[model samples]
Target chain A: MAWYFSGDKAVYLQIMEEIQLRIISGFYPLGTRIPSVRDLAEEARVNPNTMQKALTELERSELVVSQRTAGKFVTCDEKRVTEIRERMSSECMEEFLSRMKKLGFTEKEASEKIGQHCAKNETDPRN
Target chain B: MNEILVCSDLCKNYGQKTALSHLELTLERGKIIGLLGPNGSGKTTLIKLIAGLLVPTYGSLTVGGNRIGVETKKIVSYLPERTYIPEWMKVKDILDFFEDFYSDFSRDRAVEMLTSLNIAVGDKIKTMSKGTKEKVQLILVMSREAELYLLDEPIAGVDPAARDYILRTIITNYNENASIIISTHLITDIEPVLDDVVMIQNGTLRIHASVDEIREKNQMSVDALFREVFRC
Candidate 1:
């Protein structure tokens, strides 16, 4: 379905990211049962084995846990989800700072520029 | 789970013109392999050998642990590039023939696909458009639930909507234990669905790797890599 793929990155990694996004975005609410491997694979148009691997990764990261006889569930821990969200925001800021630095802007100049840019644009998509 | 297909030093020759040479590879279950090459890169020859239509000159090939013969043919469902069914037969007639010939064929699945595509069961094959004929052939092949699906140019000469339909049908119908190999020149259209890619040049294997690994190593899509590698 091309829902979890951008045709550039690894499919399983993308699947992992997508599931994580779902957890943090509350599409998969805390402690809710996630889709089975076969359903997720069918939805993502990937092999079930690939889906299994991605789910394994999620389990390893403690974002999801598997119960005996039951299915995988998103962790009920909201603190962990917030931690991931903050980590992603920090990474996004690092990307912005490095990009502005490459354009010959100092850190303070970059910060001031961001402030001025955000003040000028009512709803900056980039911002 | 056993390997779906294995080839060892596989070679084929037509009176000194080599069609395939030293083709050693192994395919596992639950994979969607994309067999890609230019016009004369032995793509069809490899597919034909697996389909049991052609014999290799000096090598061995096996499918589902059986040699390329009746048993292998029974488990391997092939869709050749050109139309192979009779023109006069109705679509329903073809479904019945497939069901009779292959024990794995699901008549209900075929009928459901035809109905969903707005294709009538009583419609004659020759009367339908080329696109409809192709869709019918694809539906017949896919309904079999074979261990291995060898599709040769299944999406060629079709509209985008039809292409999407064909891809979706393939993804939904195939089971995890079976594998599918799609041989096509339309790389971009089938790139997302491929798990592995096998590319040959001048009757020799050039590249065989997983799709994710190729993207990670080359930093480009499979289609772009094909264009660069086969550039004149």
Candidate 2:
């Protein structure tokens, strides 16, 4: 219904994606303290119970760790972080390429368009 | 205690009018549920019944394993749609009154919220605007360590920013063991904070389902479903 939720599936899974994105983007960063469930829930405007389930999911994925009463922190594992980042990038590229194909461009042409966009300072050549 | 509120064939009639029909529902603890409906849909009536402001014409409703009475009152913190604080009383005085009236009320927590909201303690209640009054009342209700919170249109008269702040306060203030039922027509604004939704129409229950289930099963936001379900 709002940011971090697409309203197509379970909120905990959506929350998990959000936290993962934060991790992949270094918003949470490696080995840094994450906000409390109450704080995160408030920030997302979601119930703390749902936020707790998401945080627990993050913990199970080894992206976050709870140190007893000290609170939750992002994982210090850099390899896992890089893996998620690459996965997200590939996912985005796949979606973009598919959309480009739907827009009447071949796979090679779509890749060439990306190359062209990267080659020029301006993204659109028509301008 | 596990089930925060339970209504079994609960009916409320006022004179010749039936405000609420036979409604059966149960709310579990640790949930933030939205009591959603259009005008005259018995949303207020249900909230009032839980707040002990009205007597049901027939059937029963229990809150925190106790029927609606003095015992339930002790564990239930209610924020009515209208201002309940005395016009003559100052903000500080209201805190004192709440602390004296409700055992669960924590004056210090109330003071903390008041300070954060930039409300002066000595400011008379009548002098404040409508939105501020709602915020103050919401803070007071959330500060109480009660088992169940019944908020009737908690953000009806507030600006968007203040509405967001009030929802955040509700999320942060309530303990893990507590559950809150917020009744409002502003579905989009309040949709995110809701874990479950209870829809009522024409003095009867329409739907009660978890937000996740609704989303996964219907592939739409609760607001979208609400529009379709209550479409004219």
Candidate 3:
């Protein structure tokens, strides 16, 4: 899975967003062992402490679990992960739809466009 | 308990140039204080004096009714503007060093955080980038359960995205009863979290008041007032 950093926000929050994206995209499957903080910090070119803050935020949301000697791993609870994923997706979709409507797109038109985009992606050889 | 910080006629000088001139201020507990000033305005000097890193040329600075010394140092967790950690040490080693020196440091919490960030304990600091190094420094300072936190330009060098995380960590991790004094010129970025502000100009106290009072009295953001006051 690819890692992404965002501008105009906290690094820790961006890190959390990236992790959430991975979880949602199924790159980090349920029960998968996540990299250590130092490893992630090195890869992301962020301070380990900043990385730690992101992880703490994730753990607070119950998206990841930590064990003393074994290190941190993605939460194994499929139902919880699904719930989080759906909730985030719905929130994003709502925001996107509202923005599109504000920009003069009708609800039906927005839906049709999204459907076409998804269908095209599904049939594309790149998929 | 009643007074978090007390500085009376604090003065500092470098040769003929005076950095701080008879500055007196009192800081109370459970407040987030912004130490604001232009470049070379003695913001760092005042913080260093209060932190016990630099001695005053005149007057006395005290915390919890004690003079600035080793005793006061124990309760203060300081994050300097520049890198303090050696580049050769591993992340784990840094944690160990903090654990050994600072009794209030939380090693478990630090490790757990690192794990979530995907940072390995064994990785050397030399391999990490500058932004990451700053984050590591911030984490160590934040993890301490100290009574006073002196942060010198905590978000000065980082990208905008990382600035939010640093601010968030400061908001979330700080001790409720402790006082935090942050020195910065990035006034707009930190204006939301500040409870009180102390502004300096030419090594003298210019503005010292609660954020609400300043906003109400001036009808402008701290950043705006800062620009107006220190207009070049």
Candidate 4:
């Protein structure tokens, strides 16, 4: 999975968002071993403590479990991932639809535009 | 629990003028306090006095039930507004000094932090740029497992990117049982993490309350209240 780092928000929140995205994307599949805190911090160019906070949050959410000597690993429960994906996707779609409506696009027009864009990207060799 | 720190009618005069005038404050433990004020608002002076860096002109101050002295300094780790480390020393040398003086200093943690920042231990402070030196100083201050951390303008000089790192370091390094008093005019950057706030204006304590209490009472964010209170 590709690591995304941004300075726009709190590091811990950003890390959480990125990890959730990865889980949704199937890059970090259920029961996968996530990188060590040190490695992840180095990759993200953040302090390990920031990474730890993110991991702790993930543990709190029950999406990941930490072992004593062995590092943190994703829970082998696909139900949790599915729940998170559905919740996040619905929220994002609602936001997107609201913005489109604000920009004077009707529901059908917005859906048609999105479909055309996706179709073009699928067919285009450069894409 | 009520009195993590107590200063009774404290006064500090810098020659002709008074920096602090009969200041009285009681800081409780386990709270993240924001010491808010403008420049020359006696914020730094008050912090210095409590840190035992400067002696009070009149009254007495106690930290963790003991008077401010060598013992108090041991429990309090302070980060001054400006770079306080000698410019000639290496990063590793500063670590050694901290290790020598402060029993709570975590050398391994400091070294790990330097590595994470891609800062070499052997590099001299003179060779690094000003911003990097400031980060190194912050890392050192935060690595300590002190009871009271007085961070004076920790984010003032750094760039926006570095500010996040600085805040993250504080969040990560702070011991839960300890109290952190961050003195700064930059309210927006730190308003989210502050558990309590001590608003000081013109050498007087204006307000002191938990973040939740302040929000509940004012129905506004601390940043908004700061602007309103410190408005000219």
Q: What is the DockQ of candidate 3?
A: 0.03
Question: Going through the candidates in order, what is the number of backbone clashes in each?
Answer: 0, 0, 19, 0
Question: What local distance difference test score does each model get?
Answer: 0.88, 0.88, 0.84, 0.82
RMSD of 4: 5.4
lDDT string, candidate 2, A41-75, tens digits: 88888888888989998898788999999999999
Clashes of 4: 0
Candidate 1 residue-wise lDDT, B119-225, digit = tens: 99999988888888888889999999799999999999999988888877887786878999999999877776788999988778899999889999987789889
- Candidate 3 lDDT, B11-30, residue by residue in tens: 99988999999998999987
In angstroms, the error of model 4 at B111 is 6.2
User: Looking at candidate 3, what is the lDDT of residue B110?
Assistant: 78
Q: Which CAPRI tier for candidate 4?
A: incorrect
Q: Is candidate 1 or candidate 4 better by lDDT?
A: 1
Off by over 4 Å in 4: A1-18, A33-61, A66-72, B1-34, B55-60, B82-100, B106-143, B158-173, B186-198, B205-229
True contacts kept of each: 0.38, 0.79, 0.00, 0.00
List the lowest-lDDT window of 10 residues for candidate 4 chain A: A1-10
For model 3, state the Cα shift of residue A58 in Å.
Answer: 30
- Candidate order by TM-score, decreasing, is 2, 1, 4, 3
Clashing pairs in 4: none
Better of 2 and 3 by TM-score: 2
- In candidate 2, position B108 carries an lDDT of 87
